[model samples]
Target: MSPHPQEALSTPRAAGLAGILFGLLLGTAIVLVRLAVPEHPASAGAWLTDSSRRSAVQAALDLVPFAGISFLWFLAAVRDRMGEREDRFFATVFIGSGLVFVAVLLCAAAAAGGMLATAGGANQQLWGFGHSFAYTLLTEYSMRMAAVFAFCTSTIARRLRVLPRSLVWFGWLVGLALIGGAGNVSWLELAFPVWALVVGGYVLGAGSGRTASG
Candidate 1:
């Protein structure tokens, strides 16, 4: 049986919208969190005394859940776009990695929220632990999962000829940066959002044509 016409039409649009939302929210959260939390190992204690930092952290934490939701929607839309052409093995990896990424990101956000909540008591040890835990999740574990998601998505897209070759290559590059540079280079995490923005733009611009072609 043929799929519904509306399903094809809506999937790409949903992917585009979700990608845009996810990119914006994640990017903003990252910037706000970076501003709130200094990189210096010794500065962990200062967050308790700084009202601005606390507010920034709170704002970033508030954005994370929304970002994660959008990312999940984006994944669903991508799967819908793939339809019957998607290989089960790659699809499993793609969906699994994306879910793991969101889960880890939320854990990181929760740790940050805990840090903010505990800031009132000015517990230096707790603040330090939270800071380390959150950053490790954000810059290490979550990003590695994101990298796997990117690689799987790109591979699927390439095999199915869903995205342009240039875009597929770009995704690979971004995945590499996330996998290799995220731990050492703080800003490398931004590559994920940037890639999402580009993919979103492509989806928006191509509209029905790309979906039909794919």
Candidate 2:
């Protein structure tokens, strides 16, 4: 007899491949952004004003493609494993947070643009406010991004039951990491790409077709 059509889509092997690819792409982009940052001047405001600053911003923005693609792949994987009908909540968790992610990035771009327009190589409240607003929005979505993934992962794990309990708890840790980005430790933002990568491996390597709840 043939395997169930759904079975093929939900197989551990397929999810594993997708997750690895997602991790590789996301991790690569994070590395690219981190490397690009050092090339930029220390002041966010100063960097925003210079032509060189624009280059750095462009380079950073380029990673959006990788991030966006990883997010899409994750969504597809979710649909395959969980079924579209039953997993609408997790679906929203992933997609809604993604929409917010894009919004925050756009806000960041706008904030930088505002700074570029106003800075006279000195203090400008307009530009500073814009950048601050952008960062605030970025922090908000960044936190939400971590949380949404945490919930989505748990929901999937609960259904699939392939992952060990300890690994599942790590997903919650990823969510907490985002909270630090909101405070003085903004550099901690680097953690997510790695977290996503590991989670990608876990989801693919460890998951059963039907999570425990399912």
Candidate 3:
């Protein structure tokens, strides 16, 4: 009945690719930040003075905007794939959490950028504030929102039978790790991107299979 068979098949493919891109970009940025910045900003501002660390932080900040953009596309593509099957209640949480995560991510990037710009300045207090603010936004706020988004997406995928049981369970574990310990554990943030990578790979493979069958 549909006129555009290719168009009908495109949404899942788009979602899969976008999710993969987002996960890679975001994971790289997070790794860069984790390597360059200290867990406690107040401990020492030595990274600001270290050229290599400063360069790594700068590179991380540069990747964040692109990662955020990719995430938006991934969110849109996933929502489009869900179509009429999406539950309004879970959908609201999904959309809200994703948007908030992007917002928090960007804000953290801006804070980090400001901190870098003021690295050579006389205002040590401002630098400390910015450094603390950026990490707080990233680890505390952004990750929590990411947890919510993951949970909602997994629930929707399970309901629609779009994702496998293994992925759904993995997603729940990712969500739990993020919400429960991401701020306390520096490495836990990687779970979100890793989960995204797995989900994206599966979705892309499934889409390819459908295209072949069609």
Candidate 4:
């Protein structure tokens, strides 16, 4: 079934807003988490025990859910705008990878939250495990999923000409960086948010003028 005319008309604007919110929230959360947890741990216990570090992690975790929600809205709005032009195969991959990314991100936050919950107990081993698990989820699994999402979205956008050629190329670069560098390089995952920001800003600037080509 097709969306109502009014809803269809509003989707691009909503998507732009959602994407901007998602990018900002996700980028801030990543920065906070990086500040809280060192890429190379000097001492595993310190991250969990330090008051400021713990606070930063908690703040990051708090922002993640909102980011995830905004991302979902962004996805929905984009799909709605695509309407009859969307390719089902790519759409499925795009949506699936996006949802997986969010789920893994939430799990990562939960792992960090668990560390905080157990902080007073002085369980260094558990804290270490949770910290490692959270980082793995964020860098390895979640980011890889994000890479897939980026690739699929870029491909679809390019085919539909909904996004500019340069932006589509940039999206491919961001996806490759996320896939290849996220797990190895500290702060490399920031590429995802950077890409999102560019895309979002473009969408907002383009406004209702841009529509998916049939």
Clashing pairs in 4: none
Residues 89-155, model 3: lDDT tens digits = 9999999999999999999899888878877773767767777888889998999999999999999
Q: For residues 1-214, what per-residue lDDT tens digits would candidate 4 score against the true structure?
A: 9766656657777888888899999999999988777765436666766888888878888999999999999988888878889999999999999999989998988887887787678465666677688889999999999999999999999999999999999999989888888889889888887788888888877775644321
Provide the lowest-lDDT 10-residue window in model 3.
40-49
Error of 3 at 123 (Å): 4.1
Candidate 2 vs 3: which has more lDDT: 3
Give the Å error, residue 100, model 4: 0.7
Off by more than 4 A, model 3: 1-3
Q: Which residue pairs collide, candidate 3?
A: none
The predictions' CA RMSDs to the true structure, in order, are 2.3, 5.7, 1.3, 3.1
Q: For each candidate, what is the lDDT?
A: 0.87, 0.57, 0.89, 0.85
- Ranking the candidates on lDDT from highest down gives 3, 1, 4, 2
Kindly provide the TM-score of model 4 when superposed on the true structure, using C-alpha atoms: 0.91
Clash-forming residue pairs, model 2: 158-212, 159-210, 159-211, 159-212, 160-211
In the predicted model 1, the residue pairs found to clash are none
Q: What tens-digit string does per-residue lDDT give for candidate 2 at 157-190?
A: 7566646767667766766667544434545555
Leading candidate by lDDT: 3
Q: What residue runs in model 2 are displaced by over 4 Å at the alpha carbon? A: 1-54, 84-95, 106-123, 179-184, 203-214
